[model samples]
Target: MASTLKAVGRNVLFGLLMAAAFPIALAAQPSHPSQKVTVLKVNNGQEVLVEINGEGRAVRLACIQAPLEQQQPWANQARTALSNALPQGSVVEMELRARDVYGRVVARLLKEKIDIASPLISRGHVFAYDGYLGRCDDLNYPRLERQAQRSKAGLWAVEGGVSRPWDLIEASGRQTQP
Candidate 1:
């Protein structure tokens, strides 16, 4: 019985070691590779349409959801803010991740090596999106969001400022029903 228990313990330890090593290996593999593209338009704070290799592709900002244009206090601001940061005809680098349900390639846009999401999230223009893939570690997002909330920056300045787009969509769905 002692020998059997020892074998089991060894197996468990091996399994734990493999589990811990998996993510580090995956991180080394680079889930999203950087690609240069021309910015056709900033769809919103969290989405942009770009021309890559002469093809137009919609890229949603990974790990964030900006308010829609109708969300009052945030919608229009989000769009305008993104537009200002990435103007038309601007060339930028995109770290492309997997696609969403809408077929847009989720990515992190970088202009002059500066991450575009930083300004949006830090200023309270968007939220630290929790719906993205868990394995993709976006460091400093939670910290930036907390600072924005504490400072009452951008949309956070208004009462009930941090309303998510998904929640607003759901609320509108309920309102329109018979």
Candidate 2:
């Protein structure tokens, strides 16, 4: 009985030491942040799941939403650009700003592996999404959009150009706050 208790105590002490050395709180703490990620899937029209270090989860792009899967003139180019930016297993450092009820992390997408939010804006993919109007004005954005439209890139390639996600969501009788 005495020997058994001593062995158990030693095991307990070892366990405690290990835990103290590396607390459970420290688990999954990213060594760095990624603003971009692999397009795990275009979940629905507004949101997507991206992988950070092979672990997948949903991330809400900060400014504009790409065209939902069904919407014609959808930002197909945006999706393609994003896909190219973050290929599978590509390291995308994200700075998680917050979480929505949908269990998605809201963040500013990066450029050149930085948290610039330039990619979404420069491409004219989103209209400086009202939630972030102050950040980038719609003036030059339209120009960029025009450029894309001229090139028939992605959604622009569509004959009438891509209908904004807001228009589609509203047409569908869904929320259109953006």
Predict model 2's lDDT versus the native. 0.58
Residue-wise C-alpha lDDT for candidate 2, range 14-96, written one tens digit per residue: 99999887865576344324455655664433345778667888777665566665654445655655665555554455665
| Clashing residue pairs, backbone N/CA/C < 3 A, model 1 | none
Ten residues in a row with the worst lDDT in model 1? Answer: 169-178
**Model 1 agreement with the true structure over 1-178: per-residue lDDT tens digits:** 9999999999999999999999999877655678899999887678889998899998888887787666776878888889999999999999876777778888888899898888898998888775576524755677888899999999899886766777877877754200
C-alpha lDDT score of every prediction, in listed order: 0.81, 0.58
Assess every candidate by TM-score: 0.76, 0.52
Where model 1 places Cα greater than 4 Å from the true spot, the runs are: 1-31, 171-178
Judging by TM-score against the true structure, name the best candidate: 1
